[model samples]
Target: MDRKHRGACLCNRVQFEVEGNFDSFFLCYCEHCRKDTGSAHAANLFSRSATLNWLKGRESVRTYRLDKTQHSKSFCLNCGSALPTHDEHLNLLVVPSGSLDTAVDIKPDARIFLGSKAEWVDKLDCIPGFDTLPQLER
Candidate 1:
């Protein structure tokens, strides 16, 4: 039996699903990943056997590729949320972990591009953790 994972964009305009197990997971700290996610790193799940099916709003998804590099990302045009994109060259499907609405059984396999990580990223554990958004000191 194939496992199904559901996902959607922030606006809920774009909905999708992936069937089959994820093969690998990675937290990428490369420059393109940081810029693509607007964060220190991008958490992505990869699979060569899984199949992606669009439930709705497939037209809302757009892909961007860097001019001189193979770095690319797919995002919802409405809410700008990350989505999965298939790499033809690698024959792999890469999905942003945060984009999924369902619980994931696979954990990250490794953190890549450590050399490109931000200096402050190493201090993440030292910072106070919050269950939810904390009150801002205005």
Candidate 2:
């Protein structure tokens, strides 16, 4: 049976469903990825055969492609949350892992572009973890 995954934007302005299994999951530390996510890395799932269907708010979706680069991102114009982008040139579908409302069955295959990884990313395991926001000290 084929797998299906549903997702929505932060504001719930955009909703979609991907109707195929992901080919690979990658944590990318490239400079463009870092800037796109505003974090240490970008967790994205890639699929060559998957089809993206916009369930709702299709008009609210917008895509931005960097000039002179293959880098592109699709997002909800209302909340600026990352959404799935289908690259016609590559014939690939790229989905942001966090945007999915359903559970992901696949683990990340690899971390790419490690040379551009943030300095603080390496020490993340050594830092304190919290279940929720910790109270500020008086």
Candidate 3:
């Protein structure tokens, strides 16, 4: 099978290929993500298990597990680039959408944790906003 999405760190010190179309994509304005990305929102992509594998720089990959101890955010230790996100409950992996080598047709369809969005962030007119992750489709 052909792999679909390939990506690397800003310095190209690390690289990975993610397979399959994104199952779900959303923007997170939640404080944790905002602090991690140093951006107002973090673009996220959900991929199936076995769809992600590091092709290089595995030594530079690191895991940041929130003290809450549930989910661990995967990123490049050297460049601080986001990789895949692991949610304990959902058992789904979220890839940092920006890491894609090229843009995918999947646009972020939702905004989450808007209640905690930064004061400077302007309101978007039409996208659905949720205080938390939406109910997963079975």
Measured by TM-score, the strongest candidate is 2
lDDT of 1 by residue, 1-138 (tens): 668999999999999999998989999999899988999999999999999999999999999988878788999998899999988988889999999999999789999999999999999998899999999998
lDDT of 3 at 131: 100
Model 2 per-residue lDDT tens digits across residues 1-138 = 569999999999899999999999999999999999999999999999989999999999999999999999999999999999999999999999999999989999999999999988989999999999999999
Where does candidate 3 stray beyond 4 Å? Answer: 1-3, 69-71, 86-89, 123-138
- Model 3 C-alpha lDDT per residue in residues 1-138, reported as the tens digit of each score: 434788898888889887766777889898888988999988888766636778999899888888964545888888788886556577677888888896777678899989989987885555788999999999
After superposition, the stretches of candidate 2 with alpha carbons farther than 4 Å from their true spots are: none
lDDT values, one for every candidate: 0.93, 0.96, 0.80
TM-scores for all candidates?
A: 0.96, 0.97, 0.79
User: Which candidate number maximizes lDDT?
Assistant: 2
Worst 10 residues of 1 by lDDT: 63-72
Candidate order, TM-score descending: 2, 1, 3
Which has the higher TM-score value, candidate number 1 or candidate number 2? 2
Candidate 3 local Cα displacement, residue 11, angstroms: 1.2
Scored by lDDT, model 1 comes in at: 0.93
